[model samples]
Target: MNKTVIIKGMSCRHCAMRVEKALNKINGVEASVDLESRTAKLNLTNSISNQQIIEVIDGVGYEVVEIIDV
Candidate 1:
């Protein structure tokens, strides 16, 4: 499954990397963050909640604006 999350406050590559790392910490989740679009593309091999993803991103000082299953 794939999900696209719109995020805010990502200013640069470092910010993008931070969000990517936080998402990747979840089991069966692979994330790539793009600062240009202020979005994160996630690949999931297992079930995970949208709130979980939001919390993870929020925990790292970023904000999840929206989550869309794709």
Candidate 2:
């Protein structure tokens, strides 16, 4: 499964990489963050909830704008 996470308060590549690392730490999740789009594209190899995804981003000090399934 794949999803897109729209995030707020990310200003540069550092911020983007931070979020990317945080999300990637989660089991069964792979993410790539794009600074320009302020988004993270997520690939799930196992069952995962949107709430879990949101919390990971939030725990890293970023606001989650939205999550869309794709």
Q: In each prediction, how many residue pairs overlap at the backbone (N, C-alpha, C within less than 3 A)?
A: 0, 0
Tens digits of per-residue lDDT for model 2, 1-70: 9999999999989999999999999999999999999999999999999999989999989999999999
Clashes of 1: 0
Candidate 1 achieves a global lDDT of 0.95
The digit string of per-residue lDDT tens for model 1 on 34-70 reads: 8999999999999999999999999999999999999
TM-score for each candidate, following the candidate numbering: 0.97, 0.97
Candidate 2 structure lDDT:
0.96
lDDT of 2 at 3: 97
